[model samples]
Target: MEISVRTPAVEPRAMWSHSCTLDDLVTPYAVDPTVVARLEAGPGWARRWTAVWRASRARVVCPVPDLADFPTLASAPVRSFTWQARQRHRPGLQFVLATSRMHGFESLEERRLLLALDFTGGIEEVLSQPFKLRFTAIGGGEDHTPDFLVLLNGTAVLIDVRPGHRVKDKDLVKFAAAERAAASAGWRYLVVTGWRRHVAAGLDALSARRRPMADRLGLHDELLEMVAERPRRFGDLVEATSLPAVARAHAVHLL
Candidate 1:
């Protein structure tokens, strides 16, 4: 009996963000905040954001522009940086703009870091490798749909293939719910964006099982325990990590 191989689903491309350090891109427009508010939900797989604009009246509002001001925005005001990070979070893209003024608030170096994320695409490759499980790549499914609900080792893993960037409340909620559910299910859950997107310069096949990720996530001992003890589902993992949402899901995947 031939076990016909199944294809992993193809994910859609929504409005992913683009990072920029340009100060001229900042513009405070006046519109009914409802639309902006709805858009401010940022990009993700959820469909409820439309309702937010339905009840909103045409009110004058200043929407913080996209990551156009990320470079200068950090230097301008922490509040501005935070706001941009929240508004410009595209579901598909990384929007990798750093608001940190670390290392004596250096400018050139920060830009370089941001540039590496934008051009080199390191985050997508690195992050994607750890989140995936071994499976035959029989390509099928919708091109415009969100990632398919994946089951690895009999555990559900919800993947959102966005790039590395600031975390938002909406995205946080989905990831959080997955984390909560995984803890309840004692399963593995992950949001694999960035790093993998760029293919880590196409080294995915070579370094798919790299070991450094365990150290980065700080999940060495916990992983050892879970595999040995065997979690039943999400709930078990949650209890094991005592972690909530994305962090919890992350811990489960680490194992």
Candidate 2:
């Protein structure tokens, strides 16, 4: 007797955020027209951005005027990483299923943000340390690099990761500069303070089944058929399956 194996099913994107809590995690930054004009005239605005927008190995110099129409999804990180001894911050790489690439992160909070973005889905591309942003804020000349540049539904979103309490007065200045630049380029800006209650925990649990899984026993189809009628409690849904123990993992994948 011969047994045939089927290809594994792709893991569905996790929708861990609830409607009520989405606002708490994502905070948009807006500014008045005067500040926007000042930022555009500053050095950061006059200076070109260093990015790899065309080829993976080649870097492109982009002017601020061209940013609104730049194809960010095709871009690469502005700079690479080299770890040194006793670094105060934790630096690591995370493999994102969305882009099938290992993204670099300078800190643990960045790592979590990557996971959340990956699970959220609809992101075409994610580039770490995407560009070197130089802007003159109220204080004086300030040079900064944003954490990540993500393309969602063909729109560019510039993101910075900083805990609410950790954000100081100077940090706000840099953020404001970034926000203004991002706006000038027709891109959205967001400061992710932190996740809402239970969102992190839920993401952890769902990520366990984030990879492809083989339905050797045909339990995936059976599980779906069972839930076709109406929504069922997770515990009860798994318990009603043909093989409850194995179905638990499949059920989570189906979610």
Q: Identify the leading candidate in terms of lDDT.
A: 2
Model 2 ranges with Cα > 4 A deviation: 1-61, 71-75
Estimate the TM-score for candidate 1.
Answer: 0.23
Model 2, residue 216: what's the lDDT? 98
lDDT of 2: 0.71
Q: Across residues 1-255, which tens digit of lDDT does each residue of candidate 1 receive?
A: 211212234433432223321111111111223322332232432221110000122212111121111121112111111223555432222223232222111122222223333232222211211111111111211111113233333333433433334334344434443333334335444444333133343233322332334345555565457757863465666566634444454553443
| Candidate 2 Cα deviation (angstroms), residue 254 | 1.7
Model 1 global lDDT (CA atoms, 0 to 1): 0.30
Per-residue accuracy of model 2 over 198-224 as CA lDDT, tens digit each: 667777787888888999999999888
**List of clashing residue pairs for candidate 2:** 44-134
